[model samples]
Target: MKTDLNIINICLSDTPMQEFIRENRILGRIISAIPEIPFEKVKIGECIRKGREDLLYENKKTGAKHTKITIEEKCVYVSKVLKKVAEEHNSDFLILDGFLHYFNGAYWEKIDESVASDCISMAAEKAGFLPVEAQQENNKKKLLRQFIADYKCPPIQTKDDDLSISVNLRNGTLKYNNGEFTLRDFQKEDMLRYQLSFDYDPDATCPQFDEFLDYVLPEKQAQDVLMEMIGYCFIPTRKLKLERSMMLYGEGANGKGVIYELVKEILGKEHVTGFSMAALSFDANTRAQLSGKLLNYSSELGGKCNPDMIKKLISGEDVEVKTLYKDVWTMQDYTCKFMFNTNSLPKETEANVAFFRRWIILPFDVTIAKEKRDKKLPDKLKKELSGIFNRVISGIKRLLEREDFTESELVNRTLEEYKIRSNTVLFWVKKEGWFAVVPPENTERKSAKVPHVELDFLYEKYVAFCKKKGMHETSNATFNERIRKLFYVQTGSTNNATWVFCDKPKEKDIPVSDDTQSPKSYVERFIDNLNEEK
Candidate 1:
C-alpha cells in the first residue's frame, strides 16, 4: 500500500512527536512510509522489522529485539541533531577560561556544565539515540561523553581592543566615536562576553543624579571634571594617553561615597572591582580580579602605597596576575582605571613631577549636616541609572573631542594641596615657616645683611621638628634639595654652606635664649602661630 507522508507529518507535528520531529526532520519522512502501524502508536527510536511486503513496529522499551537501525546511523543522527541545536542557540560551543558560554542575543553568558550536559542528553534521546536494555545506563554515559567531545570548541582569547568604545546594553551595543553615539543590534562577531544590567535610553533624564552632583561638586568646572573622569572610565582603552588616577578626598560625610555608589550602579557591579591601593599594589590575587574590570576603586585609601604599582596600573602597563590554583598569567594592555576615596592622603609617596602628574585629586569639601541628610538618596539615584548612563555617554563624547580631562581651578588647587600633604618634608616646611619668602631687593629686610643660618643649623632644626611631630626626616642631602625646590632663599657656599637671605622672625616673637629652647616647644609655638594666622 502507498503510504501517506502528509498525514504522518501532521500527526508527528503534534504533541510529543512535535519535539522529536523538530530535532530530527529526516526521521519523520522515514517513519511516515510504514502503512501497517497507526501513526499514533509509533514512538521515537522504535525498532521496525521489514518483512517481504509490509513493515512491523516494536517499541524498543518493550523488550523487543533490535530490527534495522545500526549504531553508526544513530551516531550520524545525533551529530545532525546537536548541530541544529547549536545553530538555533547561535553558539560555536566556545569555551573561555575553562567555562562554557553561549550567546543569548545581547551577549555571551556563562552556561553551567551540568545544564549543558543535560541539554545534550535530552536532544540525543529526542533524536532516537536512546540506550537499550541492561546496558542502557552505560550507553547513555558513553553517548554523552562522545557528543561533548565532538562539539566542544577550543577556548577563545579576548583582546583589549575588542571592548574598546563599545558598550553592551540590554537592548543592543552602543558604540561611541568622536561626538556621536550609534546603537546597533548585537553581533556574534563582536565577541562581547558581558553586558550592562540596564538598557540605553538617550531621552532619559536623571534629575536626582544632577542634584546629587550639584550638591557634591558645587563648582560647574568641578562637575565637568567629574563627569569627564567618569566618562573616561567607560572607555576600556588608554589610547587617549591620559595616564591619571582620580582620588576623591575629604574628612566628613561629603558626597564622595555617594558618587562612588552611583558610578558602581551605572557601570553595573560586576564590571567594577573594589581593590584598595595597597592590595592592587601588593596582592597578586586582587590583581587577578582586575583582569576584565573597567574600574578599580577603594573607599578607605590610606597609608603608604607602592608608587611604582600605582604608576603601572594607571599607565595601562601589562601586569602579572595569578589566580587561585592557577598559573600566573600576564594580562596584556591592562585597561582598568583607578579611583580612590580617602579621608586623608597617604603618609608618604614619591615626591616628584612624574608621580604627582599621574594623580587627579578632587576635594570633597561640602559636608552634609545631620539634619539635612537624605537617607533615601541612593535608592532614588538607582531609579535614574538609565538617565545617568546617558549623561556618562555625553561626558564620553566631550572627553573624546577634547582628548583630555577637564582642567579647572579647583582641580589644580586640590592637586597642589594633595602634593604638599603627601610629602612630609614639604608639609613641614610650609607649616613651620622654616624658610621665609625672599623680599624685593630694595626692601628693608633684604638689605639687613640677609640674616644667614648655617646649613648644619637648619638641618638640626628640621631633625628636631621631625622628631617632635613623629615624622620621618629626609637625609641632609635630600633635605637641601627639597628646600631649594620649595623656597626662594639663596644658598651661599661661604661660611660653610650658609642659607643666606633668610629673614628672621620679628624681634618680639624671638625666644630670649633660642639655644636653650627644646624642639618640642618650638614646634608647639609655631603651630600656635599657624593656627592664629588661619
Candidate 2:
C-alpha cells in the first residue's frame, strides 16, 4: 500500500494579531503599496491521528523502530504534527486557504521552532520568495540558534504567568509569545525601546530595538531623540564610577516599567536581573525576593518607598532594611542595574551635590503632548513580521551556542537582541544625569572638575589593598565606597560624610581647608611625577 502524506497548515487569522498589527501597521502601509499574493480557499480531508499507531513508526532505511512519533489530536496538535513532517521532508510550499482550525482559546502550546521555521520557509517559498536567512551571509552566525536551544526560562507555563507585555518598537505591535496585536501610537514603541535600552546599551542600533520600532516610529528624528534620552549607561571611566545611574520618574501610565520589561525580554529572562529601588530599603527578604526571581514581583512595591534610599544606595552608601520578618538584613550594596517606578524622585536626594553628581535622571512624562498613536496592521506586513520573529529567535539561539561566548559575552549578546550595547556599560553615579561613558573610577573621570579626586583615591586604595594582599573593590558597593571616601577626604569634610564634591563648580579644582591653591593639582602632580620617573 502506498502511504499518503498529509499536509496541515495552522494560521491564526481574524484572531487579531494585536501586537503584530500595532507594530507593522506602517509596514502594512508599505505592504499595501505592493500587491498581495492572492490566497484561495480550498477544502481537503483532515487527517487527525493520535494513538499507539501514530506514536510508532518503522525506519525506512534501518528497519528499526522510529519510536519518536508525534501524536496529533487537537487542531493545534494535528497541525503541529503535520508541520514537523513537512519540515522533515523539507516541504518548501505551504498554502492555507480555508478554515485552518480556529484557536478556541488565546494561549496554546507553541509549535516547535523547527515547525515555525518550516512554516515560515514554506509560506515564503510558495510565494516565490526567499527566506530572509538565505539573503544574508553574515547572519549564518549559528551561535544564536545554539543559545536558544540551551536557553530555558523560569517556565512561562501560562499567559497569566507572563508578567509583562512588549510592543515591537520597530512595528508598534504588541507581542506575547506567538500572539500579536496592533496599536495606535508609535511612541509606545519608542517608550518600550527606551525602557529596554534604559538599562543595557542605550547608545545605538539595537537591531532588536529597531525591529520593534521600525514599523511604529519611522521618523528618524523622533526615534533618535527618544533613544538619546533612554540609551547609554555609566559603565566605568578611568577607574572611577561614571555618574550615569538612572532614576526614571513619572506617573503610573507614563511607561516606567515598560523600559524594564524590554530589557528583561531581550536579556533572555534568566541572565538579566532587576531590582526595585524601593526593595533596596525594604527588608533583605523582599529585596532578594524581588531581585532574585526571574519574573514575579510584588505590585505593592511601586507605592511603598521614597527615592532617598535608592539615592544613597546608588552613591555606594548603605541603607537599613525594614524587614517583615523579625530578622533584619543590612541590604546596602547594589551592583546590578536598578529600575524604579515612582510619582517623583526624592527632591532632597535629587538636589544633593553627591547624589546629583552620581545620578542620571530621565523623566518619562507620558502626559507630555506628542503625536497621536498609529494603528493599522495590513495582512501582508503581518505576514512579514511573523517571519521576522522566527528569524530573530533563530538568530539568538545560534548566538547562545557558540564557544566564544563567555558568561559576560552571552549577557551582552542577549542585550543586543533588544538593541542594548554591552561594549561599554552606563551607570548612574548619583552626581550626574544619565551618561554613556564607562565607570569613571576605572577611567579617571575626564569630565570631573576636581583634580586627582578620583585618581588619588584609587591610587591610595590600591596601595593599601596590595599591602594587605587583598582586593578591596570586589563588589560594586565596595568599589563605590572607595570612590566616595576619596571624594570626602579630598574635599575635607569635618565629619565622615556619606558623600562630598568640590566647592568650585567652574574650576577643575577640589580645595581643602588649606585656603590657598597648591602649585600642582593632585591629579596633575601625580601624572607629572609618574611621567618623570618613567
Q: Highest TM-score: give the candidate number.
A: 1
Q: Runs in model 2 with CA error above 4 Å? A: 1-240, 250-260, 268-276, 289-308, 315-334, 348-350, 365-534
* Candidate 2 C-alpha lDDT tens digits along 1-534: 123222112122211332342243232222223222221100111212333445455578997544431111111222333334333332211211100111111111123333333332332223323334311223222322322232222222223233333333333433333332334333211212122211211123335445444444344433332333222121111112232354454564444454455434543354344555555565455554322122321112343455566555554444454335335544322223344444644422311234344433444444522342222222223334334333333332232233111123322222222111110111112222211122223433233443333434443544454346432223434444434422333323224322223223344443434532232233233223322441
**With candidate 2 superimposed using the best TM-score fit, by how many Å does residue 365's alpha carbon deviate from the native?**
4.5
Measured against the true structure, the TM-scores of the candidates, in listed sequence, are: 0.68, 0.26
Badly placed stretches (over 4 Å) of model 1 are: 1-88, 93-101, 110-164, 434-450, 486-501, 504-534
Model 1, TM vs. native: 0.68
* lDDT by candidate, in order shown: 0.64, 0.32
Candidate 1, pairs of clashing residues: none
User: Per-residue lDDT of 1-534 in model 1, one digit per residue for the tens?
Assistant: 136887666644434533454344333332232123222223233433223212344566895533354444454455555555565555444554334555656666655554544444455555544223212455545555565566555445455454457778888899775458889998766666678878889899999788777887888888877777777876666456688888888888898878888888777788788888888888877887776567887787755668887788888887887878668877665557889999877656625556677778898899988876887888888888888888778778877788888778998877766666655666775666554334212223333354556667777887898889877788888877655544334544564364534434464366534323333333334333332441
Q: Which 10-residue window of candidate 2 scores lowest in summed lDDT?
A: 95-104
